[model samples]
Target: MAAETSDQYETLQIQYPPSHRRGPLPLPPVSRWALGSVLAVGTGGFLVLGAALAALVTLYVQGQAELREARTELLAAGAPLLPPNSPRSPGETPAAAQRRKDQLGRWLQGLALGWRYHQGSIYFFSSERKRWDDAQLACRASHAHLTSITSAEEQEYLARESRGGTYWIGLVATGPGGSWHWVDGSSYSSAQSFWAAGQPDNSDHGEWGRESCAQIHPVGNSLWNDHNCNFTFFWICKRDLSGP
Candidate 1:
């Protein structure tokens, strides 16, 4: 055994078995005349080519064994098996796409939108409430961002699931008078918003600062509101496929 090595970003743990000797398996002889004069067709070439073929066989067998062992280890640990590295193209089949999504669901486990994953992103709703900044920090701790509602369908789903609970969303005031931004770096200026009537007026209402952060709080059946950043509210976290 050896000590593990770590850096600021990651730590690696590797263990190697003791070394062993390996040699080419015994192979039947191949006549030099069968190959060609171009192979330097000498007696030595005959032996070398035979050994090379045997070595290739041995390497293939060894690689297959290693792959099986690794797959077994992953299964025993309840880990999701990785899919192929190729990107999905139009020619890809539905079965392959489903397998990819299933693998993602297994990896996502405790945090996803149940089975309704949204456009390669998962959602996590916090149980406790916090100020807007603190809520964002909490989501970041999980390698996620505060959720941003991008479409009417998504907003409907969130509102229905929220069940009257106030949640701090990712939108924050980026400019004066109704200008807002989502924290995930997506531009929402021209996008559809769910602002309630007369919302985001930057009212003080005796609070120290004006409303600056957005939430999924409903007023008169509307789903968006601007609240003071200091107010505590449970938050939703969105982790895209690119997130850790």
Candidate 2:
């Protein structure tokens, strides 16, 4: 019999040996609609996947930009030196406690940009120079005071971190009785003092005032030096983690 024709099929003839005579066999049907449907579904799925990936990337970039903007704004506003509040009181509302926690987090985030939280205190080592009095004022502005190293460990850490640079500490010579004193009301003798040999000799540099202010001289060793209060130098300030 002759081959039948159809809109859904394509046919091809297969050659065979003359001894095995037979009529042309019909080829399997190849539907245009099925092929188009498969291509369309595959393409749509790939397009959807690509769009999803693009959306994710866009969201990530937007989130990072917002985060950076928020951090910059927080730092510019300055950080508070006050410690986080104590655990919520029995009468305190949950909303109030949450607000306080969020505020504390903002403070910490701003402070982390320029201060190091260490051993119940946050210390700031400035790279800029200022006079002793000006440096003290700067510290006060930050709700801190020039470093009054209360322990040997603090002294050692300051010396190490401040190596290769001189910094004004809290020590001064004009106490109540013309004795050395720390700005935080601690006497120089109270701290684990490490004055350089022959320091505080009251050298005036042949100027108007005496060498009354103390600075960290970490060149040869972690020792202290007496310098004129008017002298400009880098400074170190520490804010207590506790409240009064």
Candidate 3:
């Protein structure tokens, strides 16, 4: 009976594989080192994937911020995202918003105040108390001088713009009723005199005698009056380059 029992046990042991043996079994290797290596490889792959995803996210955010800054600059320069006739609101679809922004950006590039290439000449207008000498000195510091109306066209243009205010011109009589000369040493012969009636009287004010300065005042008709230079009035300034 004992021999039969031993033989049966050996037969049962042959049917089942030993724990250390491996074949086409569903279970993996039981070695802790092997298991740890596999787990480490899996963790490393996961970390690499996480890093890639994080980089993608950062790039997306930076691109979005740059686009927003460009849009804001376009809007601040008096450019609107949508035209008055557009049938879209701020709450509209993404397509509509993008279209509006593009349209406005194109329009802003064509504005006159957008940018200037060159400025003509510097002109000045002042209300502060300054003698003719002082005024000329101030203009020189700015690399400019009192205005000189060189032609009839310029005179007419100035008369129209000056309106009714008395402003200084470059023409001044060095000697009583002498040849009028510009501050830049140019003769006044080129100018078409649009002086007001009874101008340059040079009335004696007891202190400095008659007025030595030349001024322009546009009455009902667009004409200028040579007044005392001592009078304070807002002057017009011209820049060799275009103005702001």
Per-residue accuracy of model 2 over 178-201 as CA lDDT, tens digit each? 588789765566347878776656
Clashing residue pairs, candidate 2?
Answer: none
Candidate 3: tens digits of C-alpha lDDT, residues 1-244: 1222223223221111158766776866579898899999999999999999999887666545544554465466543445535666656786756656555433233122221111223235565535555567766665556777766776666676666665666677777545577786555662356665655455543453455667665453645445445545445433332112
Residue 125 Cα positional deviation in candidate 2, in Å, after optimal superposition:
0.5
Report the number of clashing residue pairs per model.
Answer: 0, 0, 19
Q: Which lDDT values do the candidates have, in the order given?
A: 0.67, 0.69, 0.54
**Which is the winner by TM-score between candidate 2 and candidate 3?**
2
Task: Give model 2's TM-score versus the native structure.
Answer: 0.57
Instruction: Quantify how close model 1 is to the true structure by its C-alpha RMSD in Å.
Output: 21.7
Candidate number that wins on lDDT, 1 or 3: 1
lDDT of 2 at 148: 89
Candidate 3 positional error at 118, Å: 11
lDDT comparing candidate 2 with the true structure: 0.69
Off by over 4 Å in 3: 1-120, 127-129, 220-222, 238-244
